[model samples]
Target: MITVSACMIVKNEERVLARCLDSLKGLVDEIILVDTGSTDGTKEIAKKYNCKIYDFKWIDDFAAARNFSFSKAAMDYIFVADADEVIDEVNREKFLTLKQHLIPEIDIIQMMYANQLEFNTTYNFDKEYRPKLFKRLRQFTWTDPIHETVMLDPVVYDSEIEILHMPENNHAVRDFDIFQRLIQKGTAFSEKLISMYARELFIAGEDKDFLTAESFFTGLLEQEVSEEVIKLIQCILVRCGRIKNDSELILRYALKNIATGKASAEVCYEVGEYFYNKDNIKEAVIWYMNAAFETDAELNIHYNKELPLEKIALCYEKAGNTEEANNYREQAAALRESLM
Candidate 1:
């Protein structure tokens, strides 16, 4: 049987920390908790578990904190965990069995991270596979018969264990602050980070958040960028234009987005919102129809799903088309039900 070290980085997670630790108790051989400046009873709770605890200074970088926690792990494999996550009894047994029977050649283990849509964070899916466990040390091996080369890719295994994510509240506000800080510091964003930032904004950003991101996304338009990045930038600018009530900003990008011959649901929804706010119900419904049927969503799927459907239903009701309104409402309800 292989020993597993559960590692976590947390701050001010006093409310849910104990619950998470309780679920992890017998499954892992050891626990390593790295506290990033917690002024709460989080340390006291860690003491109850008799886990190895380390204090890490807040560096505005989660990777840094995670790496610190992983460094303290002394077991054969390190299991990355979060204070907002837990494993149920069924999955806990599965996890323990996997640990006992796992092959030594496997370097990474992926587990399903479930209950995502409840808080509707950056992800669109309710459950997805995420790398949760790792072999502490990797042994290099050569492959092929004649011209041998070292294997570069880690051997990965997908496990049946599912980790339930039960956060008390959405962390978008905290994530937005970090994104804004990085943007203001002129830090270059990788393609993945750019996509994640756009998704988080579309899912939970307020008017102020869009306004704050307006300048940065607009700057990207002036540079040479990928087509996908351009689409993301267009979506961001459209929301910013709508929030600022700038018709020129809206129409400019709306025209650019339309010229791409592949309009995005986000831009279409924003256009519908623009017309709706102006009381042009007919034009709004036309754009909303485009959002629902014509364009694919670039960010949040709800823009192409329930959001436009709900608005179309409202517009029809306002236009005295009660039958059509009911039809669209029913379609929206059915769509949501199917996803559930």
Candidate 2:
């Protein structure tokens, strides 16, 4: 069996820290908790878990903090998790099994990060594969100040484990503030960072921020970005146009997104929303139906599948098609029930 050290960097996470630590109690060999100026009882909570706690001064660099925490690991492998994340019983069992069978050649273990799960269905609100488990080595250091990630070798294995993130606050503005500070300090903006910065501003939804975010996203559209990122940029552009009440721009971007042949359910739903808001019931119904039936596996954001069904039901009701309306409503209800 392989020994695993659970590592984390946190501050003022007392609300969720215990939940996170409790979930890892029996799964890991050690717990390394690095506190960055916590003004709460987070350290006390860590002590309860018998975590090897160390204090570090705030440096406003997430990677530095993460690397410091990783340095304290005294096990064969490091398993990283945030203060608000948890490993459910099923995944914890799977993790133990993985440790028992893990080979020395496997440098990294990629697992699903279930960032959000739908209230009722088995559908995840948002999930992505990330390398959260890796061998303890000097060469594997985390990179990037914000949205940090490990530099892993190509020898990686995907695990059936999952880490569920349940954050109490959205922290949109707080993150945006960090990005802005980084920008002011003349940090080189990589394509990924630019995309994230634009997303933060767009989600902030301030009038001035929206204008700036729109410009940034527009600039990104012309850059050599991945198809997946292009789709996301286009989605944000569509939302920006919607905020400005520019129906022409919204339709243009939404159509472009669909033309990519990689459009997500949310992108299709945005088009449906445009037509629905304009009282074009027939056109809206087509797009809504498309969104409801979309089967793209690559889409990872908050694409509410039930929204389209409900919208189609409303469209049918407005058209005096009571039978069709009731049918779609029942479909939506059934889907929601399955989630629960």
Candidate 3:
């Protein structure tokens, strides 16, 4: 079996560090903990896990910290983990088997970063996968600072290995604080940080930052040119309107998004819902029809609750399309049943 090195870079994570390392104690051959100036006993906990701890200065760049940690690994494969993540028994078994005979050609392993959770009997965000495992021999490097990404050669071996993220979010404390620092220092904002700062600004209900967020998001799109990012920009524009009730800006993005083919199902639905709520049935139907069968596979991002389908069904019923109305009515019932 090949040796697996579990590595991490953390600071002020005393509360969750032990639990994170404990979960992987059996799965990895060694643990490498890199502390970026932790005042807490984070390093002391690392010693308990027999981790080969290293010290790095607190640079605002997460990629720099992460890359420094990976450089110290003395194993064939390196598995990176956050202090907030834990591996379940099923995933542990899979990792052990994969380590035994990892293909030489494979540069990275894409594991499922499951983010689903429940609180007081309500289902929260759905889970998604990200490439987290690596072969240090391939010299794979991480890029960006905030939402850092691993740069690997083509054809990453897909592993069934999955991790459950029991996140202890101090978003207001840690994330925004970093953004505040970057802003105060006049650092030429990283694209990743721009996305994060925009999100945090939105969450804080800051209207002035809406325009700034729009510019940064659009700039990121121009630099990276991703459809997903464009859709997010549209989302911010829509939310800015909702929070401010500024119909002027809302109408601009709504129309612009429709033109660019970047509008989400939620966006179209919201536009439709706005008209529907205002008793403008015809306009609402046009928008809802566009949303219901959106071409963007990612556009249906968990907001198509029964109400949206039911609303569309009602719209169709009013438009005298009994067939479409009944079809949507059935869909609404099925969705409601599934949720129940």
Candidate 4:
């Protein structure tokens, strides 16, 4: 059987830490918990689990803390876990079974991460595959009999084990703070990070959040970027303009994308919101229809799906068209149910 070391980086997670450890009992050979300055009873709970706990100084970088925790693992495989995650009895059995039968050649294991929409975070999918287990040591082998070359890619396996991500609260505020700090330090954002930041803003960001992020996204427009990244930045600026009630900023970005015939659903939705608030039901309905059918969403998927549909329903109601309003409302409700 392959020995698995569960590694976790935590801070002030005393409330949920015990529950998470209890769920992992017997499934992991050892637990490595790295605390990043926790003043609560979190360390006491880790002691109860006999975890190999180490203190890591907070560096405002999650990757750094996670790497520190992984370095302490001493098993054949390392399983990255979070204090908010729980594996039920059925999945626990499946995990143990996999640990017993997993081949040595497989270097990575992916598991389903469920309950994403609970807090309406950046992720669009409610359940998606995430790499959770890694081989502690890698083997380099040559393949291709003639003119053999070293294999560079790791062998990966997807498992049926589902881990429930049940966070006590939404962490968007904390994440936004980190992103802001990174931006202040002049760190260049990867495309993935840019997209995630835009999605988080659209999903859970408040007016203050949008206002604070406006200048950063606006500055990005002055730099040369990919077409897709430009579209995402445009969407962010349009939303920011609407929140700040700056008509010039909103129209400047919105018109440019519309003229290119590549307007994203988020831009269309923002335009619809602009008109909707002005008591222009007809114009709002047109824009909402464009959002739902004419354009694809660049960030939040809801902009192209449920959000526009619900708004269109409201627009029809404002126009005194009960039949059309009910139809659109039913469509929106059905779409929501399908996601569930």
Candidate 5:
């Protein structure tokens, strides 16, 4: 059996820390909890699990704190989790099975990070696979202070395990604040950071920031980026253009995204939205159908699935096809019910 150490960096997570730690019981050989100056009872909760808790000075860099937690691990594999995340019962069983059958040569294990599990009024169900499990001997380390990711070899294995993130505290502007601070400190932005920064500004809801975000996103497209990141950046740029009421720019980015050999659901949906805004129901329906029928899981965001269905229903309604409109609405309702 491969020994696994659960490593986490936490601060002021008293309410959720115990719940997260409880889910890891009997699943890992050890738990290393690094507290970054928590005034709450988070350390006391960690004591209940017999976790090796250590205090680390609060630094702006999250990777530094994570690396410090990893340094205390003595197991063959290191598993990272946040205080706001929990492994469900089914995924916990899968995790145990994965631990038993894990190969030594697998440098990293990609697991689903289910950002939203059930449908709520605030956010839709969002999820993606991330490399959360790593081999200790591989010397993998986390990168970036914000949106940190592990540096690992290409030999990765996908696992059925899922980590459900349930955030109780709302730190909506925290990441944007960090990005601003990094910028003020003269920190050179990486391609990934640039994409994320643009996204933050766009979501910040400032009227003037949308134009700035569009400029940054336009610059991002000129740089070499991975297909997935390119799709995400294009999605943001298209949205920004739409919000800015720049029809030509929106069409340009939307067409560019579609021409990427594999237009993602978001790209298709945005195109549908663009045509719909122009009162072209027929053309909008075609693109919305493309988004609705998209089979590539990685290419579809959570909203991509539901939004297309909803838009298609509206398009059919506008086209005076009552039966088709009702059918599409029923399908959308069923999908929403299933998610709930």
Candidate 6:
């Protein structure tokens, strides 16, 4: 059985740190905690757990802090958890099983992250994935400053190991504030900084800042850039454009990738819903037809539970496409009838 070292990075997480540490204590051979400067009992709790603690300066980049934490591991396999995340007994047992029956060739393991799984929680599924468990010898590092992710290149397997996040979304690090302050300081900073700043603006709901972000994407596109950064900028532009309903901008970006492959069914459905909400039934049907026929069933990832077939049937009837409208209505009715 491979020994597991649980690594965590934190700052002023006094409220949630103890709960997180308590969940993983005794599960791993070692617990490594790196403090970015917490004036709270977060450090005191670490001492009680005999956790090997280190100090990492508050850098605007999260990867820097996380990478620093990973360097402190002293076991064959490393497991990372956040100060606000919890791993239940069922998942912890599953993780233990994976380590005991591990294969040498599997350098990394993908973990399912379950966000907000309360018994009565309502919303679409909050399942996201990332590399959470891996071999220390592989020397995989992390990338991206804010939502940092591991950089690995060895064979990976998706284990049923899961994690739950109950983050303090309202509270943010001081560095997040600093990033926005620097955005207005000068043009000396790279477009990367601008991209990061724009994300902050979108979250904060600053209209002018969003325009600045939209401009930054345009500015970067004019320069010679890496393919990876280009794709990121395009995605950011699409999000900002949608928020502003900038039709011209949306059409331009859509055209870039629209014909290279089929347009996204989800996007078309959203468009149809947008018009339907405005009571523009005619435009809604046109977009909905374009969506359902042109796009595949797989592309409507979470629409069934959220919008469901009955809603689609209702939209068609509202648009007065009686024949096709009735077909959808019957389908939805049959589903409901079968449930009874």
Residue lDDT tens for model 2, 112-222: 978544322123445768899988963556878999998664578988888887888666666666766765676656766765664454334465566655665676666
Clashing pairs in 3: none
Full ranking by TM-score: 1, 4, 2, 5, 3, 6
Model 6 regions more than 4 Å off: 99-106, 116-129, 138-157, 168-212, 223-245, 255-257, 265-279, 288-293, 296-340
Q: Which stretches of candidate 5 lie over 4 Å from their true place?
A: 1-3, 37-39, 57-60, 88-133, 138-164, 169-173, 183-212, 222-231, 258-264, 274-287, 293-304, 318-320, 334-340
Residues forming the 10-long window of minimal summed lDDT in candidate 3 = 116-125
lDDT of 5 by residue, 77-123 (tens): 99998998898899999999998988777888999878654422123
Which candidate, 5 or 6, has the higher lDDT?
5
The root-mean-square deviation over C-alpha atoms between each candidate and the true structure, in angstroms, is 1.1, 6.8, 7.6, 1.2, 7.4, 8.3
Alpha carbon lDDT of each predicted model: 0.92, 0.77, 0.71, 0.92, 0.76, 0.66
| Pairs in clash, predicted candidate 4 | none
| Model 1: CA > 4 A from native | none
lDDT of 5: 0.76
**lDDT digits (tens) for residues 45-123 of candidate 1:** 9999998999999878898999898889899999999999999999989998997899999999999999887887889
lDDT of candidate 3? 0.71
Regions of candidate 2 where Cα sits further than 4 Å from its true position? 57-60, 88-101, 112-115, 119-129, 138-153, 162-164, 169-212, 258-265, 293-304, 336-340
Give the Cα error of residue 291 in candidate 3, in Å.
4.1
Between candidates 1 and 3, the TM-score winner: 1
Between prediction 1 and prediction 6, which has the larger lDDT? Answer: 1
Model 2 C-alpha lDDT versus the unseen true structure:
0.77
TM-scores for the candidates:
0.97, 0.76, 0.70, 0.97, 0.70, 0.65
Evaluation by lDDT, superior candidate among 2 and 5? 2
**Clashing pairs in model 2, backbone N/Cα/C closer than 3 A:** 120-339, 120-340, 121-339, 121-340
